[model samples]
Target chain A: MIENMTEIAISQLLSETQKMKYEDYRFVTASCVSLGDDGCDVIYHFDKDLEMKHLKLRVGKGEELPSVSKIYFCALLVENEMKELFGINITDIAVDYGGHMLLSDEELESPMAKQQITIVEKKGAK
Target chain B: MSKTVIPFGPQHPVLPEPLHLKLVMQDEIIVDAIPAIGYVHRGLEKLTETKEFTQNTFVVERVCGICSCMHALAYCQGIESLMNIEIPDRAKYLRVLWAELHRIHSHLLWLGLLADAFGFESLFMQVWRNREKVMDIMEETAGSRVIISVNTVGGTRRDISKEMLTKISVIVDEIKEDLKQVEAAFFNDYTVKHRLVGVGVLTKEDAYALGTAGPMARASGIKQDLRMTGYSAYGELDFEPIIEQDGDSYARTVVRLKEVYQSINLIKQCIAKMPEGEIVVPVKGNPNGEVVSRVEQPRGEVLYYLRANGSKTLDRLRIRTPTFANIPALLHMLPGSQLADVPVLILTIDPCISCTER
Candidate 1:
């Protein structure tokens, strides 16, 4: 259930990768996010002409996608930050994860998850 | 030789922001430098998507207070590009005026901070005291001292009157005289040279390979100023990219000092040639495209990328600050310097860890 706005059905991942590379877009980083219903969104950020472009690739909730850290040195940190923040798992990454700078293990219920959270307007709260 | 691990930061006096460094040392000489960031990460990137496009101007401005105006300007430029709005010619020149004022203030602030790191107390106070004039000018004109919230999506929110411009012109002359005194202290003084002369050397090749930006790269002989792209009213004005041959700490200081004069000159020209027009355009509808904008901030080059999906809020916004690109270069330079010179050397890159971790 990809919510992408791409024109075609991007079934061939290798061809898409080749197409992106051929277009001269340097792969900057890929970050993972967990969605409900056994689905996850893997966002790949690329840069060319000083502009950042995001492409979302979805996988099963427990599945893994390919890593681009081999292509860009900056990706390792992005993948780690996403894993720590969104409770998504990344595989085959080279550098140290730096062990989750912000959150602890028990609080990994995903603060960023799109769930029912209170939004009390300050004007009427008191 | 065994490589002993020595921790360099997280609370080092040399760095303005908290950046942890684990250095592998052989006796007093460093062999490798491993950097650990996120010490001050406030998740600014995630927050930008949540904030309204107008409000993000303030949020992003706080990304680095030293380069606040530049941050806001870059964000505005991206939004303007998306909207296909051509700001008035007068607004363009006004943007240059305020932005150059920001550059001057940021560079002087860095010079003061650098002097303090070297224990040159008198020089530090002199530079910062002179910086107050720029702050006063900013507050008087833009309504805020540090995070001057003048930049808007289509143009700027504030407009300078003819009287304000005359006052600003007088202030610029006063600040230029004071900068000359500060420069004399930095260049002619024996102690500053003794400490910073040969410390933290990065050759031109190393700087280029590591993608160092701003004065750090310029000091290493790379004349790649983004101002040459003719963004804002810089294309209409006459100026030159400041460059230096030496890649040492002192050379970086020289480059910044020279840039202060360039910024002052740029502002003077803008004031002289500024025309009368609306400060901003009426921005309508939702911006719906991906646009990239680059601006030369005090530390180096700052890149802002904005992606909108035809909404009031942007879908994604990413900032690649100069400090972020310079960190890798610092990793290469930190090794091989003496232990005591770590603070001085660390400061040479003008590491804004907040900007990096943001």
Candidate 2:
């Protein structure tokens, strides 16, 4: 399990990210864990001199979260992926792929957060 | 001057993977380069949640064929931490041994690609020809060449016999000897220097700010390597993070070239100090916690985020591969670069689309 994780409000996302950037912490990557009916928990991982630090933010379902790409331009890719795959609406990504970065728009929206679709086989032919 | 936009990839002679860049050119100079990815996306992260925790080990290995062992190693290490299971010392040494061998072959593969980017076909053939010896060593020892599934939850699934270890040691020495023959062409040749040196420069400030990892960061004089975190036998190993300060394509090339040598030395050290004991331990329960693991792959640091519940299936698995993190730096370097140097510049980052899009 991870250590040194500090939970913060979603409003503090950009400012906290800016703080890490000011402190010279390398933005490792962010992961969004969908809580289903409970929205999502977004975690931002960072490292300074190989010491790991993490920030966790809890957001409501379908919430348009703020993008940290302004503070750290490198976060654009993950933010866009989160937008496309998790159905999390992130506002102002440095490079927004409009939900088509890692996936095409026609494939499936928020494929990770969506409920499982079971396929029913046609029995007449057999 | 007229502005012309050129699409650089998704198909190119030098590209090893499908990475497209929309290069905005003003005459012969590139003004902006917009990267277009997802061409190889398989939605593997989303797929991980459906599979049981144990089965996901095999799934993660398929993310990228070249660094499959490292992927397994990181996944297993994270699971072991969640379960509080301590792998045997012999298992730890064996992990390091196989990992360094992967590094040797991976760097060699990059070297060949770099040579090919500059149209040095003979050099490319020679480098890959030497690389086959490493593949042979892995096949002989692990019974699989590319995606060697040697790692498991508690420890390793296989063990190397003493005779095989001796053979690996001899083969690696020969690899070191063979690399020297192509060293001059890469390091001192006029065409290579002309194409690589001073092109796509990333200063130390830009590298850190852009959050680049592995060789992209290290080559620009950042002393950040996840190996220094020492998850496995890296703590006991004797090595330093190779750094080059020039912040140019040549500097990046030199950094990886030196790393190939360093990996050879580390492999030799592992062979000499490998302890004999049980390679695995039994596990009793599913991992029921959240964990993040980092491993230094040949390209750079790869981060894994895993969330498991009390059941067999995992809640989520997120992989922030090194190539994904390096794309911003690549875009940053693209501007103010020559149009002809785009492919060579892309190769310098050693982009792996499978790993990035996974």
Candidate 3:
């Protein structure tokens, strides 16, 4: 509902996020919403002087998305979270965890993914 | 010099919440710090998919025990926006009252934890002892000590009577008096000053770049606060964001300590200006849109993003907790610091792993 929310291409996410930084907009947070089998929507929220701007990106499975951590270091945490929990492949993270940050062995990994059980069961069998 | 890797947490005496930091140190100085969380992750955000809009209020409240009321308020505000409901004036005032109370209690809890971190056990006991008064106020009004589940979709679930308001005012006065002593001890005590005065310095530029929130940013002279957005009854209240230019551990301490007094004043203003009206309005229809709600919690800015599809359960619920935002700031501050001062630096941000991992 926020007027400043703008949808951008997956390729433009890094550039747009860098532009927000140059415009003095603080990187607030990032979120990922599953769009079923069509892939997921990654929403990046930014703010300056209480005014907010959201940049959304749509990416499908096997698609590699650029990381924004180079522009905003704080993005690393959320990016790693998205990679681990949502199974999004965020490439070139400034501080790459290589898929080991929040999730552990006892937990259900990538529960937000559409084929969560299949992925986990496959990994478990190994 | 040889390098050593020290795992700071996941089980530490000073940390009440579980947060693991892998500190790469060169002798006594930290070279790099890598943080690992999710020990307390309950996947509460995912729970919103199965819970109804009304029931999800409670689910969000449980996201963090310290700032439960703010979580509920943010969730309710998002849902209220979705349903296009204008909450009653009295409900807004009541929400602010409970929110300020939560702030006071949360800061007090953090101050106590900081004291314990520095081995000031007696100070920690005294701070928690005074914190009990705020807990009593919450229990008396909201019927719960920590997770005061008074927030609903259209309005609040509970209301305070006129007599109860007077009693709360009296208790707040006593709390203000008690906080003065705690403030003096924190600000003037030699040990606290020596340990915290110049430690963990995050300059204004670094703070802005790192996107630190609440007292962490305010302490660094950013002057950023979500309360300035005037959500709930905050627009009607008269108060200023407590700012400190030092950007050190002591500055962060001073900001929180002074904000305790500010919260007390805000609560008083809410009590005096509270309008007489219905507390709860009947909410109709399921939400079918998206909304972003930001609230200033005791720790910092808590953001909630909600999306619904004309159904009882929400489609996606994302909570961007303050501690989650502050972790990067912590990572920035850890390097170039002595190993022993790590606890103080960690506590300076008032990191809430429960909220971060939720």
Best by DockQ: 3
Model 3 lDDT tens row, B1-358: 9999999998988898888999999999999999988787898888888888899999998888999999999999999988899999999999999999999999999999999989899899999998999999888887879998998988899999999999999999998988787777899999989999999999999998998999999999988888888899999999789999999999999999999999999989999999999998998889988889999999899999988899999889999998888999999999999999999999999988889888
Please name the candidate that would achieve the greatest TM-score relative to the true structure.
3
Give the candidates in order of TM-score, highest first. 3, 2, 1
Off by over 4 Å in 2: A115-126
lDDT of 3 by residue, A49-118 (tens): 9899999879887578898999999899998888777877788889876666777755555777764533
The candidate scoring highest on lDDT is 3
Q: Could you give the CAPRI-style class of model 2?
A: medium
Comparing 1 and 2 by lDDT, which wins? 2
TM-score of each: 0.83, 0.96, 0.97
Chain B TM-score, one value per candidate, order as shown: 0.97, 0.98, 0.99
lDDT of 1: 0.74
Docking level of model 3 = medium
Candidate 3 chain B weakest ten by summed lDDT: B176-185
Candidates in order have lDDT scores of 0.74, 0.87, 0.89
**In candidate 1, what are the lDDT values of residues B131-243, reduced to their tens digit?**
89999998999888988888888888889999999998898889889888779778878988988888888898677655578899899997778888789999989978988
- The true-versus-predicted C-alpha distance at residue B304 of model 1, in Å, is 1.9
Clashes of each: 1, 0, 0
Candidate 2's TM-score:
0.96
